[model samples]
Target: MPLDEESPVAQVRKNRSWEYAPFVNYGNGMGGDRSNYHFLSLGVEAGKVLTPTIHAGILSGQFQLAVNVMPFWQAYTPAPHTQTFVFQGVTYDEPVGGGTYTGASLTPVIFRWNFLTHSKRVQPWFQGAGGLIYTSHKFPPDVLVPHGTPGGTSVWNFSPQGGIGVHYFTRPRRSIDLGVNAVHISSASLGDHNPGVNASIQVQVGYTFWK
Candidate 1:
């Protein structure tokens, strides 16, 4: 037997659709050590819906696998300056790293859960994602490097993040999206020193095409 065309279950069926979204995100550094930093990025997200509507009461939804690539990523930090530090019982004045850092970012793995709503115009989702970043210069400037010395942090870092958002359909197969994400950045000991950005809160806006 064929699925009833008017059945409620047929309304949210999305077993094998592709989604493409172009978005922009802006963020500010948070936590103890990264308060002064600012971030901006532009990217596109591509995904394929892999599951049918699962009727699990409130958690009824579809699963999606996505990837985001941001070709233009930038971080703004305080200008270069000097500070005081104590290393191994000796107190010394060291320089802090600061300035505009340019980079590219790619999130190759994004696990998303799209919740079902009776309304045809709205859909909500939550996702957990991991990504890699490559900067033109070392990131999250070191706090204890002397003036003539270099090499503290790494140019490569990893970002693990989670977010929730909603999509509002404006027309057939087109929608607008808004989301907020909590992101953590770290070098994971890839460098001699790891002055990672502990936390950041980012806001994203995008236009999505459902195909």
Candidate 2:
């Protein structure tokens, strides 16, 4: 049968060669940093299916290896100011770094499993990925006692995340993607104090081109 003869959604799942997506994501801190932290990013995703379809029933899917690169990444934080802390009976004044922090990020490895939905319009998937972040200033700012001192965080940090998503094919070789990811940021002791964003719930929307 000719490739064009198949349904649009099937074109994406049946031994497809490549996928390219341009996506935007927004997230808010979920754990300790909830109320004060937010994130927004625009990025591109490129990858190829590395395996033939396998298994059966709910476990059936193809494996793909992809990378996501975000040149425009921003974190909205509390404005730079002094915060008071009391340890024991002593009152301490600490200067904090905040406001908008700009950076770039890259997720070099995304292990994605495209599930076999047996449907004509929707293909759901789950993926696990790890990435790197570089900001202009130390991230998740730490306290500085004397002001102008290093906040003891790092400009570079690691982001490990996982999520589930669906691709809705609007036409042959094209899809609109939606997903929700749980991401964790950590320095792995790359700095003196690693007050990373413990967890964040991110929502993503993208348009994909299939080949």
- Top candidate, metric TM-score: 2
lDDT digits (tens) for residues 114-181 of candidate 1: 88777667788999999999998888778645453236788899999999998877765677999999
Every candidate's CA RMSD? 3.6, 2.0
Error of 2 at 165 (Å): 0.4
Off by over 4 Å in 2: 1-5, 86-91, 145-150
What candidate 1 gets wrong by more than 4 Å, as runs, is 1-12, 86-91, 143-150
lDDT of 2 by residue, 153-206 (tens): 989999999999999988778889999999998888899888888899999999
Score residue 129 of candidate 2 by CA lDDT: 98
Cα TM-score per model: 0.88, 0.92
Backbone clash total, candidate 1 = 0
Compared to the true structure, candidate 1 yields what TM-score? 0.88
The worst-scoring run of ten residues by lDDT in candidate 2 lies at 141-150
